[model samples]
Target chain A: MQFVLKSVLISLVLVGAAFADGIKPEALSKDGAVTRDRHLTEIRDIMRGGRGGYIDFGFYYTPSREQLPLESQYGEHDGFAFNHHFAGFGAGEVARGRHMGALLWFDRSGWDGEDFFLFPHYNDFSLQRSVVTWGLTFTDARMDWTIAAGMQHQNLEHRGKIYPYEVDSLAYSWAHLRFSKLSAQANFYRTDWRLFRFSLDLESRAIYGGKKSGPLTYLPNVSLAMYNADEESDIDSMRITWEQNLYDQRLYAEVAIDLNDTWFHSAALKFYPDPSRMIGFEATCLNRVRMKQLSDDLVEEESDLLWGGAIDLLFARFAYNAAYDYENFFGAKGTFLVEFKFNLATIDGWLFNRGAARSAPMETDVVKQFDKNTKQSEITPMGSGSGAPKTIEAKGIRYEKAQPTATTEGGN
Target chain B: MKGTMKKISVLTVLLACCLTLSGCLTHWFVDSTTRLQIENRSSKTVVEIDILSEEDSDYKVWIRDTIRTGEKSRVYEEDWVGTFTMRVRTVGSDFDIENLKLDGGSEYMVLSDSTDGSLHYEFK
Candidate 1:
C-alpha cells in the first residue's frame, strides 16, 4: 500500500514535469494603465482554461447505501451508511496533438475500501476506465468554439477472493462488465451575444458503441443555453437550457434509458455583486423525464429545485471553490475544491496577442501614473458612463474612452 | 414561499428578454490585437507600405500591403507585440519611419501629407 501511494505521487510529479514547458514571453514596454489591463486579461484567460490534462484525485463519501438488494442474501454487510470511494485520474496531450488537442486518461476507484490494509496484498483495487479524446479549438475575440471526438472503455468487477465462491472461475467473473462508447461533440461558448453582458451557447453530440456485434447504434443530442455575463450582481443573470436525446434510437437503448427516450429542461438564476471580486448565489430548477418505462424500478427520474451559493477566491495561479448543494433525493452535501493551474500557451505569448499583454505587475502601473502626472497632456476616457476612468494605454500614449454598449453586428 | 415565487417570476422575465433580444442590432468589443489605420491624404498616390517587426519574423507579410491615393486602409491587426518599422513608397520617393511600436488594445493611425515633410501620428 505504501508503495502504491508513493508510486502514484511520483507519477503525477513526473508527468507534470514532462509536459510543462518553460518559456515566458518577454514583456513589452507599455505605459501603466494598459499593462495593468493586460495583466487582468491574462488572469481571466488562465482562469477560463481552468484545469485539463492534469492528474485528478478525489474522495467521495455518502453515508446512505452501497449494495444492491440482491446482495443482502450474501449476509456480509453491516450498516446502511457505508458508501465511500477514492479515485485517481491522470491525462494529458500527446506529441502530435497539433492545434487539435489529443488526450488519453486512466482512472481507477476503490469502493468502501480502506487505503491501507494489514498487508499490501489485501488492499482492494477494482474499478478501472480509459478515455481518449481529440479536440480542436477555434478562437475569435467574440466567439470561441471547440470540436472533439472521444472513446471510453470501462471495466467493473469484484475479485471474489474473500468469499472463495469462484477460485476456479474465469478472471473478472464475480461482477465483470465491460462498457465502451464512441462520441463526437461540438461546443460553442458565450462568444456570440454582445448585449447586456451575455452568454449564449449551442452544442450537439453524436455517440455510438456498446453491444458486441449487431447493427450499429447511435444516440444523438442537442442543447442550447443563454445567460448574462457572470460579472453582474443582483438579479443580473438568468440562464435557460434545454437538451434532448432519443435514447430509444440506440442499439442498446434498453441498457441506457429505462423510461423510453430522455429529455431535460433547466432554468437558473445567478446573482453576484461584481462577482469578479467576491461571492455569488444561484437557484436552479431541473426536470429529467424518461419514456417507455416497463416498471418503476427500471427508471429513476426527478423534477427538482435546487439552490446553492459558492464562495470563490483567486490568488496568482491557485484558486478555491466551496459550495453546498441540496435536493430532495440527493439531500444536502458540501463540496470544497482547490486547484492550481499552469497554462503553456500563456508562457509562450499566445495570450498576449489578445490585446492584453502582461510584462509588468501592478508596480509598473504606479510608475506610469507618475509619468502621467508629469506629462502636460490630460487623458480622459470618452463616453465613460461607469466612471471606470477607463482608457487603454498604447505604446507611450494614454487615451481614455467610454465603453460602448454590447450589440450584435449584423441583420438577422 | 411568496418571495421565492416572485424572484422566479422576475428571473423568467429577464430570461425572456435575453432570448428575444437576439436577432437585433450587433455590437463587438475590441481586443489586444495591433491595429493600424492609415489615410493617404498625400497628393502623390501612396503605392505601397511595409511593416517589419525587428525582433522576429513571426509576422512576415504583415509588412506588405498596398494603399491607393485617397483611400483609407486598416493594416496589420495581429497578436504580436513589438517595436516595428514602416516604410512608405510613392511614385517619386519613399519615406522610412523607424520605432513605430505597436501592441494589443492600442489604436494608432498615420496620415501622409505631402504638404509637410513631417509625419502625423494619432493614438487612442
Candidate 2:
C-alpha cells in the first residue's frame, strides 16, 4: 500500500515537473494591462476545459476485490485491466468490459444497454454465459428526466462440471447471467431549494426465451429468488437519488448498486473538490448491503456506505489516475489508471512530441528593473465592463480579463 | 429469438470503432507557472518589504521579505488568474495598488521608493 501511494506521489511530481519544464516562468501567466488583468474575465474559458465530453482510454491496475470480486471462477484476480470510458458520443456512453460490461445513460432520455460476457468454459468453448441488449431511450426537456428500456437477453450456460451440484446458488448464477426481456424505464428529476436535488427511475422488464424452463430451486431467502428456466420472470426496479455540487462543479458532492432482478435501489454522491481533477471524494449507499456482507451468519446486518476517491492528472501527453476504494467487506483496495485520450483528428500528433498540436515555446525575456526616483504606474482595478473577455497570451499560460465577484442570492 | 442481439452485435462493433477513431484529448497543455514577484531597483537595499492582497476588505499577505536593493522577492506563488487589489508595504509606509488583473502570467511588480517615502510599482 505504501508503495502504491509513494509511486503515485512520485508520478505526480514527475508529471508536474515534465509539464513545468517547457514553461518559462517569465513567459506567461499573462501580465496584461492592469484594468483587464485584475478582473480575470476569462478564467471559465481557460483552455476550453468544459466544452464537449472527452473520450478517455485508461489502463487500470486493481489490487483488491473483496467487495466486488473480479473473475472469481478464476484465481484471485489482481492485475492491469484495460478500461475504456467512451464519451463525446451522442447522449449515451457505451463502455465494454471483459469479465463484466455495462452501457449507462447520463441522460436517460437517450438509448442505453448492458451486455455481459462471463466465462467461456475452460474445457468447452461453446458453453459460455453471455447477455446482449440494444435499445433506444426517451428523455425530458430539462435533460434531468428521462426514460429508457433496452432488450435484455441472457443465455446462461450451466455446465455439469461448473454447477457440480444440481442446485448451486440462485443470486450467484443470476449475476453472471441475464434474461431475454423487453425493458421499459421512466425517470423523474427534481431540484428543490436549489440545493436538494433528487431523481427516481422506474424500470420494468419482460423476460423472453423462457423455453420449457428447466429445473427451478429457490431458497427461502428473498435475495436468492429466481425464475425456473421454464417459468416467466421479469425485473422491476426503482432508484432514488439526491445530489449537489460545489466549487464551480469541481469539488462536487462530498457526501454519499444492486439487487439481482427484483425491485432494487442504489444512490451515490461524489465530489471533485479540486477543479484540477487532482483530488476527489465520494460516498455511496446501496440497497443490497446484505449480499456484499462479510459474513452470512451475522445476527444484525445493515446497508454499507462504500466510499472512495481519486487524484487524476494529465501532463505532457501522459495521463494517470490513482484511486482508493474503502469497502467494509474488502477493507481497502488500491487502483491506478494510466492511458492517453487522443482526438481521432489529431492522433498523428497526439503522441509525437513534435506533433502538430504541440505548443510553441517562447524566447526568454528579461525582467526589467526600476531605478530609484522613477515614478511607478498606478494600479487600477477594472470594474464592470461592457466588453467581452479577451484571450491574452501569457508566455506559457493563456489568460483573460478578470470580473468582479458576483453577488449570488442563495447558498453558501 | 436471440437473433436480434446477434444482428446488433455487428452494428455495436462498427459503431464502437467509429467512436474510437474520433476520440478527443481536451486537457489544457499550456506550460506556465504563476507567481507575483517584486524586484527592488533602488541602489540601497530595502528592509521589510511586504505585498498584500485585499479582497472584500480582508488583508492577505502575498510577499513578505527584506529585499536587498536590486534583488527580487517572490511575494506570491500560483496566484489566481483574475481581478485583485494589492498593497505594498515598506519600512517607511504602505502603498495601495488597487484593482490589478492577472491573466495567469508571470510579471515582476517592479517597485521604486521615492524620496518622499512612498512606494510605486510597475509590471515589468
Candidate 3:
C-alpha cells in the first residue's frame, strides 16, 4: 500500500513538471496598457499551491430482522449478522490552464465479515476493497470541445479476507461536442478482466423553446466484443433510449429496450421538481427463454416477470430513499435507507456568498407543509392575508389551511 | 499515369500545409498569470499567496519583509533576504507562508517596532 501511494505521488510530480514547462506563456500583455509588472508578480503570488478535496466517514449497522417464508410462519433462526462498513474518498484537481486540468482520486471501502447462507461454514470474515483513478482533461473554450482520458485501478477482496494482490486496470476516453442548440458526447471504455469488456456509448441533445421547454435527448448504444472468455457466447448487443421532458425540465418520461437473446424492455416516468425534490415510477419485464429436453423427449419452457418502483426525498440536507422490489426467486422485499450529509461548506471559509449564508428555510417549510397536510384533522386558519388558509373537510375530518390548488401527487 | 498522380498529391499536401500555417501565424499571442494573497488581520499573519498562470511560464517574485515588535525606547534594525522562484503551476494556489523561515526567526513574527508582531509583505 505504501509503495503504491509513493509511486502515485512520484508520477504526479513528474507529470506536473512536464506539463508546466510545456504550457506556460513567457509574458502577458493586453492592448497598450502594460499594467505594472507588479500585476504578474501578484498573480504569481496568488496562483501557487492550491489544494482542495473531500473526506467522507460514516458507519452503518443493520440489526438482524425476521423473515417470513411463503408457506411457513416467521422463522426465529439467527438472522444475518450485523456488519459495519467504512469508506473514504479523496480527489484533487491541479489546474494546468484556464480550461485544462489534471485530477487524481482515491476511494476505498471495507466491511467486517458477517454470516452468509451460501458460506455458512465461515465464522468471522471481512472484506476490503479500494480503487484509484487519475485523469487529465482538456477543454477548448473557443471551440466548445472537451476531451478526457483516465485510468482506474481496482483492488477487490479475494478469497478469505485478503484482497486481490494484483489490481485490475481500466482505461476510458470521452469527448464532447457542443453546438448552438444541440450537444453530443461519445465515450469509450475498456476494462482488463478475465473476460475483457469494452463499451461505447453515444448521447445527443437538442434544445427547444429555450430552457423552459427542456431539451430533447436520445441515447443509443452498441457494443461489440473483441474477445470473450467463451467464444460460443454472443458478441454484440444494442440498446435504444428516448426521453420526453415535461414541466420544464423538472419532469420526464422515458422508454428503452435492449435487444438480445434475453430481450428486455422498460418504461419509466420521473418528476424532479429540483435537486432536493423528486418522484418517479417505472416498470420492467425481462424474458429469458431456453429449450430443455427431458429423457422422454419432452420439451418445456420457463419464464419470469420482475417489476418494482422507488421513491426518494431530500429535505434539510437529509435524504430518505425507499424501494419495493419483487422477484420470483426472492419473493417480495422492501428496502429503506436514510442518510444525513454534512455540508463541508457550512464550516469552511467559502460558506458565505456576498455576506449572506445559504439557508434551507424553503426546504424546511415545504417538508413541514407536507407533514401537516397529511396529519391535520381539524380545520384551522392558514394565515391572515389575501391568501388565507382554506378549509378542507372530508368524512367529518377537517384539514385547515389547505391550499385551493391542492392535488394528489403520485409517482414511482 | 502513376507519376502524374504522385505529383498532384504532393501539390495538394503542400497547399493544405500553407493554409494551416497562415491561420496559426495570424493569432499567436502570450497569456498572463494572476497573483492572489490572503492576509489574516486577526492573527496578524499572512495566510497564503497563490500564483495562477500557465504551466510553462517561468517567473519569480520578490517579497520584502518589514515587521517590528519590542520596546519603543530601544533602537532596533531588521534585515530580510532570500529569493525563490515559482515552480509547478499545477500545485499553484493559496500557500501558507507562516512556516517560511528567514534570517529573522520565523516570517510570521516580524512586525514594526510600534506594532505587535505581524506579517507584512512587499510584492515585486
Evaluated with TM-score, which candidate comes out highest?
3
What TM value does chain A in model 2 reach?
A: 0.32
True contacts kept of each: 0.00, 0.00, 0.00
Give the poorly placed runs of model 3, Cα more than 4 Å off.
A1-98, A102-112, A115-128, A161-210, A214-237, A275-303, A315-334, A337-412, B1-124
> TM-score of the candidate numbered 3?
0.34
Residues A1-412 of candidate 3: C-alpha lDDT, one tens digit per residue: 9999999966754443233211001010010011111111111111111112223222111221112111111101111221111222222333332244444434333222222212222211223334454455454433434443344445543322212333333333333333322333333334322122122223222111122222322333222222222225433444444444544444555554555554454455555544112223333333334355554678775554433444433211111111112211112222222222121211112221110112122565578798888766555557744786686655677669866553556443
Judge the docking of candidate 1 as incorrect, acceptable, medium or high. incorrect
Off by over 4 Å in 1: A1-110, A115-267, A271-281, A284-412, B1-124
**Model 3 chain A: ten consecutive residues of lowest lDDT:** A23-32
Q: Estimate, for each residue in A201-224, the C-alpha lDDT of model 2 and write its tens digit.
A: 111100111221122211010112
